[model samples]
Target chain A: MNSQQIHLASRPTGMPSQANFKTVDVTLPALQEGEVLVKNTWMSVDPYMRGRMIVSDSYIPPFQIDEVLEGGAIGEVIESMNAQFPVGAKVSNISGWRTTFISDGSDLTLLPAVGLPDQHFLGVIGMPGLTGWVGLFKVAQLKPTDTVFVSAASGAVGSVVCQIAKLHGCKVIGSVGSDEKADMVKAMGVDAVINYKKVDDLTQALRDAAPEGIDVYFENVGGAHLEAALNVMNPYGRIPVCGMIADYNAETPQPGPSNLLLINTKKLTLQGYIVMDYWDQYGEFVEQMGQWLKEGKVTSEETVYHGLDQAVDAFIGLFEGKNKGKMLVKI
Target chain B: MNSQQIHLASRPTGMPSQANFKTVDVTLPALQEGEVLVKNTWMSVDPYMRGRMIVSDSYIPPFQIDEVLEGGAIGEVIESMNAQFPVGAKVSNISGWRTTFISDGSDLTLLPAVGLPDQHFLGVIGMPGLTGWVGLFKVAQLKPTDTVFVSAASGAVGSVVCQIAKLHGCKVIGSVGSDEKADMVKAMGVDAVINYKKVDDLTQALRDAAPEGIDVYFENVGGAHLEAALNVMNPYGRIPVCGMIADYNAETPQPGPSNLLLINTKKLTLQGYIVMDYWDQYGEFVEQMGQWLKEGKVTSEETVYHGLDQAVDAFIGLFEGKNKGKMLVKI
Candidate 1:
């Protein structure tokens, strides 16, 4: 069988272009014993993937040049030699940016029997959802009385953060780049929504929106977003830094928030985290998130491309703020 | 009787000058019931005092123009109207920058009879000591196996942190501006000492000193020191920000470290704190520190200036790195 996959042609400088990636077709070998063949239906394109394109020491290793890229994907078992994964069963794996691949079953997880669409498992109920849960509750240590502020508020993890904070009886303020994103986040029960692109001063806008001051800041977009959040942070504020999507594609290192001194003056706590650190508690998160979804208190929003050919465009669209929610590719 | 006090003549724009302060002699009123008269013997001039010179919202209110400045001080109770404090008792108070004051017994802490000099209460046995202790054990949560890096390592709080981490069996690396300061920090059992002034690249110097990478960075100096520490930090590192003495005198806001994204890639925790937050645990810290001092595991170091006339110079010297250990004015 032939499989089509995307390969990292060269490391990206600043914003990525189509020339940085290459589409390659390779023949798949017959499945060995205990192996399962998966045909990917949906794959995720996340901002963190930009970090893996560069050669540097990071939490995860950098992607090698010419190698097929990998990420979160939902697939179905077309053929299986393992009893754990039956034929025709849907599963989740980390063999994304490809249409078909053979998994050893050890890396494949059987999708839950929930009534939600298969793509939902790649977004709201998957890694992004778990990231939002861990960062807001465990990292930030959110309280019911906390006035929460979130950047990239309509993005996958951020939308989850906004809804969760609101559901837990916290006043949530969201910052989005466009009017459409603002409305989407506002509909998620956020107390206030700021169209950051329209605002002359983000600090003033955040201050006006959150007159009580923010006790917890979910840091998704770094740069000016972090600076503004610091300006309006209350004493003993908690900042859980989940992502810095704004600077992910910078050609050169960008200067950090100048008011970093506020961390000392305000006695703030800023912690960075990755979802993989909290995988041990995934079962608990899934159970709670499933309940919220069943009760219609939460949702899964996606902006998906049609085929594997558009995967590069979908990934690049993330840095351009072209996606309202989780950016995905349906292969 | 008369009291000589140092008043803020005007707020300083950058590094303070003698012109910004004025010494005034005022007549003392008769002590009321429950009041105690304190004749200050030793007054402290710390880097944190620079924040008070500017009118801004901070953990503590800024110093008022034409008003007496306050800080940590050790005094003798020459006369007392309260029975709880004896006539000759020694006490620690927050009425520094003055030769004498009338206290209502509310802000006085009786100095323990540990056979140490009274001025030790203004440095090692007082607020600065408690700050290092809390920031190391409670904030950084240091482990014996961890590699610790401390900036301004020969100064008041940093010296205490170096000793405490060493006593706990951790490998310590210290950064100081001069060979004399480096020698003092090295004598405290630190594994490595870097004379940052002689080094061409702080990041390279720190990398050579800590090849295994740092697990905890005791941040007493900000700017390039912080940037270098971040470059050499290990995964899941904790940074207990004590003070940013290097930027204390800047007339305008300075740009922060450009590689702040490493915090996300390495999952670093950078927390800023004031010693006041841990006052409830002061007794516990004092008990431990007192034992350490008696056992000769810790030593008090000071750079003293005689008379209240030198208080302004002593305070200004803090920004210029003129003090070796704790900067004090013996009035």
Candidate 2:
């Protein structure tokens, strides 16, 4: 069988473009014993993928030229030699940016039909959802009385963080790049939403919103957002750094927060984390997050593209803040 | 009775000079009920005091002009009306920079003679000791297999950190300002010492010393030292920020590490703490540290100034790296 896949054509120097990706057709071999064939339906595009595109050392390996780009995906089992994965069963896998793939079943996770859309397995009820849960509750050690400021609060991981903080009885302040994203996150129970693009002075805006001072800062966008958070943070404030989307494509290394010394003067803790570290608690998170979803206490939002060919565009759009929540490509 | 005291005559802009302090003789007031008179024997001078000299909000209140500067001190109670404190009892209090003081006995802590010199209470067994203990074990969550790096390794707190990490069977790398300080820290059993003054590239020097990368960074100095630590830190590294003495006297904000994005890529935790936060564990710490001293497992080093008149110079000398270990003035 033939399948359409996207490959890295070249390394990106700054903002990645369609020129960095090449779509190709590859023939799939017949499934051997214990192998399962998956027809991918939903593929994820995230900010961390930007790091993988660069030719440098990172937690994950860089995507090589003329090779299939990989990520989170939800697929249907079209054929299976393994008894555990029956034909027509739905599953989640990490062989994304492709229309169909043959896997040994080791990297695939069984996905039960939970009544929500299958794409939710690629978003709010999946890795992005877990990222928010662990970073806010465990890493930041969120308190019920904490006033939290979330940058890029309209994005995938950040939207879930906003809703979770609100549910914990925290005063939640969200910063989004547009009025549209501000309205979306506000609907998710964010107490105050700052349209960062509309603000002349972000620090002044944050000070006005959090008059008492922020106790926890969920850092998604770096650069100016980090500096603003440092300015308005209270003594002993905690910052759980999940991503730095603002500097992901910068041509040169960006200077850190000018007021970084405040981390000492204010006795703050700034910790960075990846969700893979908490994978052992994934089942526990799913139970609680699943309940919240059923109770309508949390909502999942996504911006979906129609075909595998649009995967590269979906990824590049993330840097431009083109998606409200999770950005996905349906194959 | 008349006693001599040093007061902050004015706030300093950059490096403080002798003009910033004023020496005055003040007459003691008549002791009231519950009041006790203390004759200070030794007073401590620390780098953090530089921040208190500036008129700004901090963990502690700013010192007012013409007021006696406060810090750790050991004294003998020459006269006491309170039954809990005997006339000849030794006490430790935060009423320093003066030869004698009158107290209500509320802020004073009774000191039992531990067989060590009285000045040891103002140093190795006091705040600086507790600072290293809590920063290494509590904040950094250090483990036996960890490789630790300490900046200002010859300073009061950094010396203790080096010894503690060595006792825990961890490899220790220390950065010192001069060959003399380097030899002093090396005598404390530091595995490797980087004489930063002699190095052209501090990061390369650290890389050579800790080829496997450092797991815990005892941050006593900021600026170049912090930048170097950031470069050679292993994944999941912890930085317990004790002090930033290098930037204590900067006239303008100093630029932070440009490669701070490594915090995210390496999943690092940088935590800032003050000893006051760990006061509850003081008794537990003193018990262990006392045992270590008796067994000759740990040692205290001091560079003493002869008179209370040298208090301001002792403090300013800290910025110039004038002391090898604890800098104290014997009144």
Candidate 3:
């Protein structure tokens, strides 16, 4: 049987439209001696993927025209000839967006939640959770009493960052797109949530939310939000940038931070984190995270889209702030 | 005996004028218990003092109008009742531009130099030296083989930063205001020196200077200098801020870095340092610095003014880039 896949038909000038992708079927060779066949069950939609799509030498490869649109995905071992992953076993792999895939199993790792739903592999227990945990602990290196300000706080990573900071005894503050997500973030016991869209004075809202001054900023949404954070950031504040969601859609970069001199005056540290480079420490992260999970110290929310065809819509919703939490497509 | 001292007569609008200082002689009383009278020998003129002259609340209080401007200085104890620092002993103290001083000897630390020029204590062996060492190793934590970029590369702190970084097996780049200072920096083993004044493109000059990318930045001058460094800074680059000489004389606070979003994109770490705040580590620093000096790993230079009368001239020359190395008033 031929394998069904989605290909990149055109390079996106701004946002990736339906015209950017083309669905087609291609014949696949039989599994090699060490290869395993995976039937993709779920896929992830992330803002960073847009960076990879651009023809720049970023953290990941650029998508070529008329090629399979590929990224992190969860799949089951439908046909495995290797002892590592037997046939009919459940697994998650980076087979991109494909109905079935043959794998040598070298880069493929087993997901811990074997009994859980396949969508969870694309949500809390997967890459988003890892990104949040690693970026918060490694990049931010938060202190317990730190007053944190998180941009895009209702999203998967921001939501996890708040919960994790709360677990670390931090006073958490979040900036969300709408009053509803702000309320949702507030309901999670985040000390404060700013509806950035409603706030006329961005700096004042941040200062009001974090009265003591922001010590740690989990920065994802950039542009005006970062400027506002710069104003309210305390001396020696650290900003761990997981994504610049606000700048991703811009055809050209915005005139970058008009107030960056604050970095010297306030002594701020801004770090952009891409979690894939940190997989070596994943075992240690999962161990601590598993404990946080069991003790109820950390919790997560999701925005799941049913059917593989909805991947584009789910990914597009990220820029529009339609997703409540982790934006995932269940294949 | 009456002691002559220069006081800050008025708050400066931009570059300070002669009217900004009030020179007066006051009769100093005899020393009391545990007190010693210090005769100012060599006085230090630093970039940070410009910041302190501004009326604002920061890590340290701003200089008040009609008060003597004080900073790190080296003096000789003329009379002492304190056993810690006896008479005829040289000490490093805060000697506000004055002929004599009354101190309790509690905060005073004896200078460490044997037949070495006493003024070197104000330059390499004094607070400026400590500032470079503390900001570089403790705050920035620069590693061996790191590529370093220094702004105001001929000033008291910046000059030494290049030498210290070189001693630590790092490739160093510097930007100076004058061709003579640039040559001096290059002679001191700095790999490259960008004459920012003549350079058509500050960013391109920085890139060409540091082809491998800048790993650490010793920031003595802010604004355009910082913008240039940001453009070519490596991911996770460390910026240790000692001063902002470029903006020190501005009538109004200048527009900050227009590209500070690079901090997030490059994952840079920028830290502001006040040398005295890290004084507890000075003993260890001085000990190591002494070895580096004795082994000829580091050299010293100074721009000395003959008398207290030239203090204003010396200070003003700093802004004009007239002085190379440490600008000091030999009292």
Candidate 4:
């Protein structure tokens, strides 16, 4: 069988371009005795992928030049020798940016037989979903009375944070790049939405939006968003830093918040976390999130590219804020 | 009876001068029933006092202009009508920058008779001591295997933190301004001492000091110190921010660490804390610290300025790094 794969052609200096990635056609290897063949149906392109494109040590290894890129992907076992993952079983794995691959079944997880669509498994109930859950409930320790502020409010993890904070009876303020994004976040029950692109001063806008000051800041965009949040954060505020999409493409390290002294004066706690560390609680997360989806308490949104050729575009589009929510590539 | 008090003449814009304070003589009021008269022997001049000089809401109320300034002080009760505090009882209170005062005995704490000097209660065995203990054990959750980095390692709190981490079997790296200060910190069993003033690149100096990377960064100075620490911090590192003495005197807000994004990449936790919030644990701290002092496991250092006239100088000297350890005024 033939498979299409996206390989890292070169490391990007600043904002990644199409030249940084290349699509290649390759013949798939026959599945070994304990292995299964997965035909990837949907692949996710997250902002965090930018971190892997750089030549540095991080939570995950950097993408190697001239090698296939990896990320969250939903697949179906079309041919399998492993009893644990029989033929026709739907699965999720980190073998994304590819149309098909043979896996040893250890890295693949059988998708639960939920009523949600297959694409939802690559978004709302997937890695992004777990990120929002852990960052809010575990890292930030969200309180019912908390006034939560979410940056990148229309993005996958951020949208989840906004809705989750609202469902927990907390007041939420969201920051988005455009009017459309603002409207989308506002529809998710965000008490105030800051169209950051239209604002002259983000700090002033955040201060006006969160008059009582934010108790929890779900940090997705760093740079100005972090600076603005620091300005209006209440004493003892908590910041769960999930990603800094703003600085992801910067050639040079950006200057941090000037008001960082507020961290001390305000007694703030800023914690950084990666989702994989909390995978032990994935079962518990699926149970609750699955229930939320079934009851219409939570919903999923996607901006999907159709082929492997557009996968690179979908990933680069994340930095440009072209996607409404989860950016995915459908094979 | 007469008392000499140090009053705030005006709010300082940048680094404070003697002109910002005024020493005035006043007749002591007659002590009412249940009140006690205290003659302050030693008063502490802390870097955190600079925060109070600014007219802003903080953990503690801003020092009011044209009013008596307040801070940590050690005093002996010369006269008492309150049964809880008798004459000759040594006490500690926030009635400093003054020679004498009449209190209702509400804010005073009776000093433990551990055979240490009366001024030791103003430094190592006082609030600064408690700050080091709480920041290390409570906030940073220090481990014996941890490689600890302490900024301003010759200052009151930093010195104690260095000693405590050393006693706990942790490899300690210390940053100090002068060779003398570096030697002082080195004498406290710091594994590596970096004279930050001598280093052209603080980040490189820190990296060279702790090639293994620091697990716990005891932040006393911000600005370059914070930036350097971020560069050298290991994955899952913890920062317990006690003070930012370097930025305390800046008229304009300083830019934070340019590498603040490392907080996310390294899964670091930076927590800001005030010593007052952990006062409930003061008894436990005193018991442990008192034992350390008695057994010679701990020692105190002071840079004393005699008389209330020199109180303002002592306070101003803190920003200039004039004090070897605790800056104190003996009245």
The TM-score each candidate achieves on chain A is 0.99, 0.99, 0.95, 0.98
Candidate 2 local lDDT, A1-331, one digit each (tens) = 8889999999999999999999999999999999989999999999999999987658899998899999999999999999888899889999999999998889989985567788988889899999999998999999999999999999999899999999999999999999999999989988899999999999999999999999999989888899999999999999998988878898987777667778888899999899988989888888888889989999998999889888888999999899999999988
lDDT of each candidate versus the true structure: 0.92, 0.91, 0.81, 0.90
Predicted structure with the largest DockQ when compared to the true one: 1
Tell me how many clashing residue pairs each candidate has: 0, 0, 1, 0
Docking class of 3: acceptable
lDDT of 1 by residue, B89-144 (tens): 89899999999999988899989888888887888878899999999999999899
Tens digits of lDDT, candidate 3, A81-105: 8999987767767766667778888
Q: Mark the regions of model 3 whose C-alpha exceeds 4 Å error after superposition.
A: A13-19, A30-33, A258-268, A288-297, B13-19, B81-87, B249-267, B294-296
Compare the candidates by lDDT and give the number of the best one. 1
Model 1 earns a TM-score of: 0.98
Model 1: reference contacts kept, as a fraction: 0.80
> Residue B259 of model 1: what lDDT?
83
Model 1 CA lDDT for position A102: 94
- Which candidate would rank higher by TM-score, 1 or 2? 1
- DockQ per candidate: 0.83, 0.67, 0.37, 0.81
For all predicted structures, in order, the TM-scores are 0.98, 0.96, 0.91, 0.98
Error of 1 at A264 (Å): 1.1
lDDT value for model 1: 0.92
What local lDDT does model 4 show for residue A145? 98
| Residue runs of model 1 more than 4 Å from their true location after superposition | none
